[model samples]
Target: MAIDFGTCFTTAAVRVEQAGTAASGVVVTAVEIENSRYLPSLVCLDDDGRLLTGRAAVQLAAQRPERAESHPKRALLRQSAVLLDGGEVATAELAAAVLARAADEARAQRGGTEPVRTVLTHPADWSPGDLDRLVEAARLAGLDAPELLPEPVAAARFHAAEVQAEGDGPIAVYDLGGGTVDTAVLRREGSGFRAVAVAGDPDFGGRDLDQALFELLRDRALDLDPEPWQRLWGDRTPASAHQRSQLARELTLAKESLSSTGTVYLAVPGYPEPFVVQGGEYRAAVTPALTASIVLLERTVARAGLTPAELGAVVLCGAASRTPPVADLVAARLGRIPDLAADPKAAVALGALTDPPAPAGVDTGADAGEEAAQDAVSADGSRRWTVAHYPDEVDPELWF
Candidate 1:
């Protein structure tokens, strides 16, 4: 089983062998949690000091915003602990809540059997300390020594596996998740791929774009009726908090709808009617950030000692990458249409199930440590690699 613990959502996938067939090849499939492909990466501190995850966390958060930490991954990067509703909660504990939920669901799918192997995908720019926390979280989640794979490398593997071609030169991956945008350049080395360079902006992502739209709605609501808008913003009651949460969720849906339609209606709390936001207007508001992401991609490629034209392929990962403006900006800046996975959010988890590329200068033959390094897997055939152990020297400042 592989888990992609994202900032906005968590996704899991498992590799299973086909039944009743001579070939019986292994196939990777996404694991559905709570009847959804993407589980919201939310955690809430309940009255008893226990952590609630997924829908429970979301529901509790709506009623008590002070007790929730909506972005645990981001919080983990900034501090070891977060104070929620006056209670100090370890960041790793918050992360463990989400991973535990994923691991439980994946195990339930297999009739209570534990997964033979577990792999977790994370941002390529994560530092050794970040990774240690992640591993600790996994252990806390009941996963013993799970393997770690870089998000961009897993994304690149998905692209290569989907197209059945490695192509020439390095493959550039542009991962725009909910809270961050990560860019990486990877080149094939023997049977596996190696990271050439990585770059990202932890402050910019789909959430920022959502804020842009939120501000647009705020401006419109204030113009329509300043009193109600002011009340919504000023009220500290639970009802007001729930209403604000609902409004934020609606706006997110509206933003996603704008991708397929020309306009979307947003019902702001304390407002009498929904407001209309034109797709073009939202696109215009987010264009600058989108372009900045493209610039980062270019910079990462350059850092890898290559140009956009030299890239064999440019792959887009994360649900935010589905935004129409993202593809347009990427193509306009990179001079090529980036490849979009069938399910961007699940790409990393699914890709982690594929065979990892061999490390450079390692013999793939059965020679103990040499074979393990070559296959990038454990002796038990489960894939295992870590950015801390990656051959290339990573810039510490890039860690988020």
Candidate 2:
């Protein structure tokens, strides 16, 4: 089993070996949780002080925002604990809850048989200390010291095996996730890939794009009638909070709808009419951020001692990479059309499972010795585990 615990959603995949047949091969399939392949990466504290995950957490969060921590991975980077509902919850504990949920669901799919090997993907720029915390989280979740893999390396592996781009040059991965954008350049060694360079902006991601659209909505709302908008912003009542949450969800749906259609309508709280937003307006609003991401991709390639033209392929990972402007910007800046994974959200998890397994009789524990041993393998051999260690359209009111 392989897990990609992401900022906005969690994905897991299981590797099935086909045996006793002439066409024996390995097939990787995404694990479905709660009837959905993408599990919400949310953790909420229940009335009993127990952590709830997936749809349960999301449902609870909608009613009580203070009791939920929406981004545990991001929280793990800054502080040891996060304050939720007037209590301090350990960040690692929050992360463990999500991991446990994924592992449990995956196990159920395998007829309650535990995975022989579990791999988790992380950012290439993560430090040793960060990896230690991740391993600790896995331990708390009852995982048997799973192997760790760098996210971009996994994406590159997927490209080499599945896409099979034409060239021996390195592959550039542009991962625009929910809360961050990571750029990496990786070269295939033998059966695996190694990261040559990585660069990213921790503060920039899909949420930033959402914020830009929200600002446009705010401006339009204020112009229509400042009184209701001010009331929604300042009121602390439960009803007001629920309305605010609904508006946020609606805004997100509108943003996604813009990717496929020209216009979408959004309903604002305390307003009788819906407002209109155009696809062009959203693209214009997010162009600067997309351009900046493309620039980072270029710089990462240069850091790898190669030019954009020298890259064999540029792969796009993460669900937000589905935004229409992202590909356009990449082509416009890099002079190459980026390859989008068949299911961008599950690429890393699937790729992690695709990695060559460790040689038999090797201790795959969360220990420095084992990690160092794995790192000693030849470039053509198995790669070292990076230790570880929807809105409907409506009549137009204001167009921004």
Model 1, residue 61: C-alpha shift (Å): 1.3
Model 2, span 3-52: residue lDDT tens? 89888888999998889788688888899999998998889999999999
Give the top-scoring candidate (lDDT): 1
Candidate 2 backbone clash number: 1
Q: Scored by Cα lDDT, where does model 2 land?
A: 0.79
TM-scores, in order shown? 0.89, 0.88
List the global CA lDDT of all models.
Answer: 0.82, 0.79
Clashing pairs in 2: 131-389
Off by over 4 Å in 2: 21-23, 355-373, 376-400
Give me the displacement of residue 182 in model 2, in angstroms. 1.0
